[model samples]
Target: MSVSVDLATVWAFIIAFAVFVYIVMDGFDLGLGILFPLFPAKADRDVIMNSVAPVWDGNETWLVLGGGGMMAAFPLAYAVLMPALYTPVIAMLLGLVFRGVAFEFRWRTRRERNLWDIAFAGGSLVAALAQGVALGAILQGVHVEGRHYAGGWWDWLTPFSILTGVALVIGYALLGATWLVMKTEGELRERAYHLSWIFLIAMLGAMGAVSIVTPFLHVQYTQRWFAWPNIILTAPVPIAVAGVSALLLRSLAKKYDYQPFSLSLMLFALSYAGLGISLYPYIVPQSITIWQAASPEKSQLFMLFGVAVLIPLILGYTAWAYWVFRGKVNTASGFH
Candidate 1:
């Protein structure tokens, strides 16, 4: 017997995977930018910047794939979402542009380095906040009228969106701190470990607050999580979160270099899985479904062939780059 799968669902998962990879890959670098203010010393800043310099540009590849895939495979959803999320989306792109420019310019000039640093941190913060707010806006549901976004411009700004924005900033900072702990040594690593602890506590609080408020936003979400046999399936996610939290704390206390970062990624994976549970089937979350938004079968099949070859090549090079740059960052050596 052969199992059958839907092409639209396949594309959905593909897009989801790309987005998740982008989050985990670029998240640490963005986190480093967020943590910059905490490390005021020039030398400390150098180490932080150097840690991500080699692969920072490459990390954004997945973002392109995810966005492009959405536009190609789900044009209707893209059309509706773009109008609804125009403000936040534009803000995110602009933030990334500033951040990228700062990343390059900071190394070129000594006198203007401080200005670049501010740009880097500010851009990362804005990008992170905008991404989270867009997510919150999606979760709260978009205003749809005959396949068009009918919501006001300011509709994306809400208390819940602000909460998620702050949560994401804290989460990214944690990723950055743990990354520093894994990639640097001596005073910097020690300082990172301390920040990791603080960020961990703050992240947990933020996660709890979001989790509590999320289910109440939509009745469907509440049912998906808390109803009957669904609870059995969903129960393990929070349990896994607790388990990972324990391991993260243990790893941090043990002073194990890579474990804290690995466990931190696991926590993120669990959170991502929880998000999938919340928003599966509905790409636009109660507005447009995966099937409803899918392009023609021929188009998806044609795209699938390209993606099949493309994804592995991306994975290969990404892995190769990381392997080449593996182990602690040397501030004196410099990546650039």
Candidate 2:
């Protein structure tokens, strides 16, 4: 048997896959943190923490893989994007660190647990919002002079970016709620189910908000989405998203344990696919493309060989971790 694939495309797909995995996996943990206040009960909160405890750190491994791969395979993009996104990227790292520390400290400190809980929730919110804002900035187009970001410090701060930040919060909350439903039972599960319904509405509203604003920000997307033949070709992405969203709602209403989370993941995957279609070759929205921003072909091919080996090892361990920790968490199951 023979297999043929463009090494650059292969690397691009690898990075994208890592990012998607991080979003689906760590998104739930972040969501759980975002929902900390809503749980009210200490025991319920503990269960929420424990449910994600085993996999949260491992989930973030995808972030490192994605970032490192981008730097290695698309050095030009890394050169431009990192400087453009310096502040938000730093803020995200700080928030992640704060949240990780809060996780450990809260377990140790009885009287100070509330403070740590606030830190955890706040950190998650900050990190999620920063990511969304950075994404919005990217979509709205960055100021690039040659291969570098020539934008102002506040370029990432805009009404559209802020809206995206809120939308991500709601989306993460929805993911978290569905996760709780899958990882818990009894009253906590019921509470999570109800919360998911609320998050679902918010998520829809966010999507509408983004859709309305995206076309105005980039005329190319408007043309791609609304032009005659292109419209016909792209129609299925939105239609599929709608179908998945409907299934998500139905799954939540039916109180199916795993289906809501599964459907939510599907919705995210569809949204990601639509975004990829809309962006196509562009690594930096309207500006730079993958081929242009990509590092040397020789370097990409070399890294591809390394990634080919590394990815399977990571995937194998991730799968094993999930299998070991599968099933509903309880108050007694506290983080180990």
Candidate 3:
């Protein structure tokens, strides 16, 4: 049998892929920014910011690409999701604005730089938490009435959603700490190594609990994933995550031959891959399947053509940005 082009399906996959990319790429930077204050000293905070300063803005381009692409490619999905997620979305956007302002003003606004730093940290935290709440709500599922939600105002803020929010905070912070370890040397690097153990364990614990809980809540996902050949295909997720986690731990334990940051990143990527698997084919999970919620073929094709051109350009610039600023960060240097 041969596969045929389902334009809607194709667009759905592309939008999903873009979102995953954004999460993996920009997530760490935001996480690091949020984790900045965890450092015992102001000098350490400066080091952390310097590590992220070069590519922090570039890291966020993924969100726009993922979001805009979703709106264009899957208009129907957006119509349904936006109303359901309205408050959290507003909060997320506001937080992102704060995060952005904090990033920019922190450097130039001398007397108010401290204030901006706090704002930046607060924004990052809020945005990350809001996202977790959104994800948890999506996973628990929702009731739909045509393209809008039938669920009540507070339905999106369930116990599961709140748990997910807290989990993500630790997850992001770990990512940030690992990233700092990877990009900085000397004292800051060592400190990041120490931080990774606690945060990574918390992330894994949260993920473990979620994995067990998801199946019972949505039997369809459980049966589909845990059944036969599908289970075999899914086996790699836990295995890979475990392998990376072990590597991260081994590196930390040994300390002398450490590559703390890069390995931690691989760990994050693996964990995210597991999430992508768990929520497969449902852009919004059980609430809306991809094909059912897709926009028209003509619309999707037109949007795809544009995205095909746009994605490459975005990838190119992102690569260039990272290359331009590749190196270890040190104290006494401005974030220019």
Candidate 1 structure lDDT: 0.92
Off by over 4 Å in 3: 1-5, 256-259, 333-336
Which candidate, 1 or 3, has the higher lDDT? 1
The stretch of ten residues in a row with the least summed lDDT in candidate 3 is 1-10
Q: Give the residue spans of candidate 2 off by over 4 A.
A: 1-5, 333-336
Q: lDDT scores for all predictions?
A: 0.92, 0.87, 0.77
Clashes of each: 0, 0, 0
Q: What digit string (tens of lDDT, one per residue) describes model 2 on residues 117-169?
A: 99999999889988888888778888998778899888888898889889888
Look at candidate 2 and tell me the lDDT of residue 49.
85
Candidate 1's TM-score: 0.97
Model 1 per-residue lDDT tens digits across residues 147-215: 889999999999999999998889999999999998998899999999999999999999999999999
Error of 1 at 5 (Å): 7.0
Candidate 1 Cα misplacement greater than 4 A, ranges? 1-5, 334-336
Model 3, global lDDT: 0.77
Instruction: Point out the worst 10-residue segment of candidate 2 by lDDT.
Output: 1-10
Error of 3 at 161 (Å): 0.9
